[model samples]
Target: MAHETDPVGDLTEAQAREELARLADLLDAANIAYHRDDAPKISDAEYDRLKRRNAEIEARFPALKRADSPSDTVGAAPAEGFAKVRHEIRMLSLSNVFEEEELVSFDQSVRRYLGLGADDPLAYTAEPKIDGLSLSLRYEKGALVQAATRGDGAVGENVTANARMIDDVPQRLNGAPEVIEVRGEVYMSHADFADLNARQTARGGKSFANPRNAAAGSLRQLDPEITRARPLRFFAYSWGALSEPLAETQSGAIKRLEALGFQTNPLTALCNGPDEMLAHYRRIEEQRATLGYDIDGVVYKVDDLEYQRRLGFRSTTPRWATAHKFPAELAWTRLEAIDIQVGRTGALSPVARLSPVTVGGVVVSNATLHNEDYIAGRDATGAPIRGGKDIRVGDWVQVYRAGDVIPKVADVDLDKRLEGAEPFDFPKTCPECGSDAIREAGDAVRRCSGGLVCPAQAVEKLKHFVSRAAFDIEGLGAKQVEQFYSDGWIKEPADIFTLAQRYGAGMQQLKNREGWGEKSAQKLFDAIDERRVIALERVIFSLGIRHVGEGVARLLARAYGSWDAFVAAVDAARDQGGEAWDGLIGIDGIGTVVATSLVSSFAQEAERASIDRLVRHLDIQEAERPRTEGSPVAGKTIVFTGTLERMTRAEAKAWAERLGAKVSGSVSARTDLLVAGPGAGSKESKARDLGVEILDEDGWFDLIEGA
Candidate 1:
């Protein structure tokens, strides 16, 4: 392979070797930042361009391929934290095909490697490539015993507890081998990601830039209980360390896993040639948004298992498979202005308002500028970076869209800047509250000193507490939350719980007041009443404390078990900052920042009083501890449809699940039980037809109550 216009062709052998070494070190750092830290220092296009340059150099001088060259590495080495699990078989990565010609080359290379004639038949299964965290689950005697991440190809971090929390992951396989490892990607749905971010934003928490990062962050949570609270799902695509062969074909193996109670991608299809494979890829790309989950590309693997064995493997990727990724849409646009938006936690975020331009069919008008250092072209260490140039208004900036959701500034053209353009000066005071904005040490954000005093921060905190993710009332929304705040109907979170008690009986004053109606007011009170009882994690997160997002709140709730225990622990750690403080900070996923925030919030007399008032009006339930082992109905999918004679539908569902069975709403092929009552309908009929066991109300009581 050669390029007629390759830049590296001009360099001498010695110069080429030095440049290759430099590129090798640069790419290694990028891989670590991307794969381990869950943060990418550069755009995907920039990374690919650099890697391509290195490959060109390596091709020109094959003898000088460095021993530590990134070409031989699939991903960075595992970062320190969890225990490392060595893979029994290497979990190799897939070679990527960014363009149609490269995809054609991949097919040709595979055919050439196999010594196949031009007319020979070649079949492959093209699967939608999920943009998520790769996970490997090992099952022994049909029971999931351990799970690990795709850390480096040879070794991974143990994440069995976190993996078990995924609803799609089967806790135990009933119909198969004694030992097997199922390989899959754990991802979050677009809807779930939006909900989580909305809650985070409402509570003044940091929102995820994209769903891929959200899924990765959720899975890598320090506490498994936190992972359980996250809406993460898995889809089995391949396997490792199998005690017995699953199927003779790649597609057949996927079907087998689906039958074994595992979720599999339905877009997977059989392709006879590269044209057919590319057609399927295009079809998937068209339906990407409708699919809900994120997919970066399409993966083509040889259909026949025997052919894969014969084709063998490379050091980092398989010889029989390749991933064809869709190109990111990029366009050059002018930076019109920079705006500073204060978040609920008072962190200042710089947003770049851009001249409208379309990228990948979506019109993008704004992009993130990160922070002050990013705008000034300085790194975390304040060293001049970003090609030794700073971003300013009136400069021509290149932006790219990834998955059509996150649009980022990829590069800047220095020559296209206006003659009199000046750098953006970040504000030193909050725009909404006029408070002192100070940048804390080791932090990228500049925060406002005013806590509850800042209206922007306070309203954001209130919105977060009642946002769809927190106390989520039916009739309440952002508009109503702001309206109520403006009218002084609700001053604090506790005031919401007390609204009906104070206003319900006073129709002349409450319901008949300005902007209030009798029906709407009663509905609001009913909604408030409905939320008086909530789970412990919900209340903890509703407090709107900095760094205590949903995941960390679950970790705290699980550690303390109940609200009383959590409050007591914080109170104990407040004055006596020794073992108690250490214990609070020792919780996984929590650092010094979160611990200090908790203690400080409790120490505030006004904050403590507000919390006490809220606690008095609410009934908070303790979160259940995770039970991954020793449950009779643990992995079984169950459904209870129609009316129940002995108990309500919710009660039956909860009771059945208490014994360890997974309670599903609908009846499917995998359903293990159907509890029916007088009006047993389609679900019961479907269960009977599928041969699923059907138990009546009396029968269910006998089985559950007696046990």
Candidate 2:
């Protein structure tokens, strides 16, 4: 939790494991609250710190990384109220750099990846990283067709009506491509936010926490009239999918967007190098307070669009851009007590309950302790942090809000420690079920062995099942899930589909229950029935298996294509020493750890039965395949060998993907085409021996020239 001292390098395997687990939970919760609920539990600064720590630890101990690691995740799945919109081009997030060294490293990493020398003139466009909801506006034939919120990168919430109400958003574009997705930030200005809050107060409604939240809430309103009444603005900074290239350079693209009636940020500037970028960042920081709109950092993107395509993406973030975040704001508060809360995964997370204090205009009374070691004043490697002073109850402590979002304890004031303050003794038994909470070897956090028997874990699993990324039953929310679970109406995900059948019109009808009526109960049943036929990925994610997240679920869904295929593969892989196991681990993102988790879930008799029952109630749809109609390479598995002259390997892969061809690293009998370049050797020979279609660089270009 203490990132001030660069403690990641010194963390032992167990410590790293524990911290990663904690981070995964924290980040997952934060992403859901912020992205789906529009109510953030932690500050952006705290989230970034935890995310950075998770990345560092994973980099150090890759084997211990969870399959649902935050590094591979984006925003949470879209909320229930809005229609889902799948982005043609994924809305990836930019990596971050907090210090000058990190910024330099980012520049050098980009240069090295592009085979550039130290003195190479790699220009970048630096602009303010707007602190607002990310919106993607799709225009077809110069008319704004749809607008969506960035939800989990791949899919988003359709908010076209709400977007049309924003004055800054253009209803139509002139001289734009046939199909273009203009991506930018939808924000509320300081004055607009103040006025909106005032209006809300006048109407006896709940006021917003910040302008970002206000803008996000307003833009996501179900009623377009409400959105129209709200003063929301947009700033076009980038483009997603395009029929044709917008510009050769990033700066030129911004200008083009501005000329096309989009409100492009006026402060955007081009920088020659890291030094110039830093200078521009400093200038922006100096004007941050008076800017009227919120900005968390300065975004620096490689100006050359070709270079950007060459660099491409790394999982959830881009390789060519980064956000240099502002420093955290600090305040002092009294540490009231430490409390341990159990999670769905059985990890006992310690949270610091604090006296109410406002760090960055938000009153925060709690902060995550990370792990027991964090409270014990020692890092993973036994290195002392916070001057080796342990945080105790009845002590004054320094708290900071990074990104002005969540408060986190940074330093303990030993001089202010009370005489009777004692070291916290972590519980060895599950507080909810009294089961043995044991820490496994090489594991940092103590997990409850109670499993599903624990009430806390059971309730949380049910909550997760209906979460935005899962079944997302419209009428069923957290409170409803909790009440129904407590009432024994639903115990597992399968139970959710069976809810209407079990209580719709029986003596134990939900309509007869308190706080529920005939219409409401029927609505809930309708929502449940509406989701009876769900996507394969959602079905997999709804199981709530450890280490399995939305991204991993998508990967598994894409690999197997259907629920039956996925189940068959999981059952075959349960033995863990056969071709099934190998295939499971061979998926691009799935590692041995994830594969084992998938298999183990099915191996359990009870869990497997639950999943089986759930599937029986679901008409699981196959994963959607990429549309490659009208392309010559559609449905073909192609391998690119050696060096590509016209484009980088990444560019070739992306191009091939766009053409509906599956790109493979190695040549096999199934290989439909092999594009070989100058340095091709073993793969070329294999392709020839395997009788695969082999094409030279020129031949490859000729074959797909127009298509």
Clashing pairs in 2: 43-405, 43-406, 45-402
C-alpha lDDT of candidate 2 relative to the true structure: 0.86
lDDT of 1: 0.82
Which is the leading candidate under lDDT? Answer: 2
How far does residue 14 in candidate 1 sit from its true spot (Å)?
2.8
**lDDT (tens digit, per residue) of candidate 2 on 399-517:** 77755345678888686689988888999999999999998766668889897789889889888999999989888999999999888988888888878777776534788888788
lDDT of 2 at 630: 76
lDDT of each: 0.82, 0.86
- lDDT string for model 1 (1-707, tens) is 12223378777887787788778888998988777877767656667778878878889899999998777887777878888999999898887888888888888888898888667898999999988889999999999999998888899888888998999999999987899899999988877887888888988888876677788888988899988878999989999999999999999999999999999999999999889999999888656545777777899999999989989998788999998876657656778888888878888888888865544534466898888888888888888777768889888787777654578776777976899889888889988789999998898889987877787777788889898658998777777778878878777888888777776785556677666788888888888888999999899998989888977787788778899999989988986478888889887567888988898888988878888988899999997753535554565777888778778987876665556566788988989888888767677778989999998888777766533
